[model samples]
Target: MKTEAVRLYGKKDLRLEEFELPPIKEDEILAKVICDSICMSSYKAATQGTDHKRIPDDVAENPIIIGHEFAGELVEVGAKWAGEFKVGDKFSIQPALNYADGPVGILSAPGYSYQYIGGDATYVIIPKEVMELGCLLPYKGEGFYPASLSEPLSCVIGAMHANYHTTPGSYVHKMEIVDGGKMAILAGVGPMGLAAINYALNREDRKPSLLVVTDIDQGRLDRAASLYSVDFAKSKGIDLRYVNTGAMDNVAADLKAITDGYGYDDVFVFAPVVPIIEQADEILAFDGCLNFFAGPGDSNFKAPLNFYKVHYEFTHLVGTSGGNMDDMKEALEMMSKGLDPAGLVTHIGGLDAVIDTTLRLPEIPGGKKLIYNHIRMPLTPISEFEEKGKTNPLFTELHEICQLHNGLWNLEAENLILEKWNKLT
Candidate 1:
């Protein structure tokens, strides 16, 4: 079968090309991708090309498709998966595949230049390895875009689930967070940051009593506050605060005041900027856990840490690149129960615009840039929904649905979008 995809051949070399795909083997499944969300990691991979650790050494020899977060329907299921997974089954994927087991071990995932296909394509074959690793997940949700977001949301889930411990003059290490303690998320108004905030606020177990979200952009901060209101958090018996550190002359001082000088028990750094990392470290309490959640493209990216505090106060740091299958399952379950992360989507486009969208993801302001693989529309921002609605009746309906949800994307909005687009196509 012939299909279209955005393939990366080298550094800053991404091409939207049409290619023939071979028939799937008995253990493989063919999925018709509907929605693929552009991620910052994909942008990094596109810019770094073969230099990325995840990219295969033979990438130049075999250029690969380049997106990880996506959801679709099973167009063809192999005989082996007939009963287990049938054609028309809705699904998503946990791209972090750790298949190797012994001395010849190599830890890698299916996305980027390492795999034969990716989410950026109109269709992708779920290889035998992916099925064996159980990374291909069946999704039951109202919309495919929300399911596509599960990958990123799972990363946030894994970060929240990360545990740390202290040993008293001993080498033994333990894991877990300080229960009901103070937590802070730096640069917490972006796409993944918003997911973290939603999970932190809604997770029923071992949640923080006080959650402080900081961002340099007041607009993002305001949007986050509006989405997750103070009144709502108070009703849940939690203290939630959003602050724009840009307005404050001293960000560290302002953060310190928010915690009443006790410092944060758990601090999450959402941006790769070194200054943000240092600031996150500065606001840690005794035995505080600083999670460097963002992935940096630069291999030599380094930030100064207070080693004195590391030993004396027991402060430590950890980082996670992506989440596992379990984390993706949790995200799906939460979304099924009405925890919508679709609010993080700020721009929407079609497969035709994915290459440009991937190239300019960082420069484009907003949360996630959702791409409908079958559509051919230009990228549209949520903020311009009303204005766009004035001309396009489809967008007019979307505007109403989003406005009903406080200007945030929801299942109804996504369903409306898909339905309208299908009709036009």
Candidate 2:
């Protein structure tokens, strides 16, 4: 089979190429990728190339695929797993494959270490290890975009699950955020931060009674409030508040004042900035668990913490990078049960736009940049669909469809774009 994909050759060296894929072995499966959501991790991999731990040292000789957050359909099933999975099964992959003999040992993942199995390709050969490790997940969601986005939602789900609280003088730690307790997300309103907000509001198992999302950008906070409305959050029995910390003189003090100086039980830091970390630390209640959700680019990143609180007050800290298989399954299950993650996607593009979009992801001002693998369109923001509709018929229909759903991307819009652009390919 022949596949088109964006491959990383070296530092900031990415190429869009069409190459012949080897025949799938009996233990392997053939898949046709539908869509991939561009992640900052892919941008880091593209820029750092071999320097990234998940990237192989021999990328110059053997380039790897450049996407991970993706979902697709099965075209052919290998004989070794015909009974377990059949052709035409919609699926999403949990990319964190902790296999010992992979290209990068336990750090190996689908989008980073593999040559023919990344999410950027139109077609891919799923290796036996993916099946053996059970990372191949069957997604019964309505559209491909939600399944692709489940990977990111799983990350926040894992972060929430990883948070813990403690009892007085007890050595054991209680898992998950404190239910019906006060919570805060510092520097929230970005793409991942929005995902955290969505999950925190809609979670059926456990949730915070008081949810406060903070951001320096008023525009972003306003956008988040519009998408996940205060009325909607109140309907779910949550007191949701969007606060712009840029306008405050003392962010920690202002946040604590919201809880009547009782402080917060669970605080999540969404930005890598030092002040945000310190602000999160300063506003913790007793037995508060501060989850550092952001990953810093610098290796020597440091932030000040109150050792006095850590010792006497039992303040806790934890960090999470990505989700495991159970977390991905939970995300997919939630989406199937009508948890919409459309709020995170801000732009849409096609296979032809993957190279530039992946390389300049950080420079782009938006949420997820969703890429349809079989199309040939440039990266265009959904917010501009109405403006672009003046000259383009495709954008006209897209604008009309988006208007029906409050200007957010939906399954109808996704299907229309695929139908319109797939013919061009």
Taken over the whole model, the C-alpha lDDT of each candidate is: 0.83, 0.93
Clashing pairs in 2: none
| TM-score, every prediction | 0.94, 0.99
Highest TM-score scorer: 2
Could you say which candidate leads in lDDT? 2
Q: For residues 1-425, what per-residue lDDT tens digits would candidate 1 score against the true structure?
A: 77788888888888888888889899988889888889998998888877776777677778788899999999999998887898888999888776664111355555574444688888888877778788889898777887999999999989877757676687765665566888899999999999998888788766788999998888888888888888988877779999888878778778988888999988999999988998898999988989999888777899999999997999999898778778899999988787888678898888888888889888899999998887787898988988987788788788898888888777787777677786854
| lDDT, residue 253, model 2 | 95
Q: Which tens-of-lDDT digit does each residue in 309-369 have in candidate 2?
A: 9998899999999999999999999999999999999999999999999888888997999
lDDT of 2: 0.93
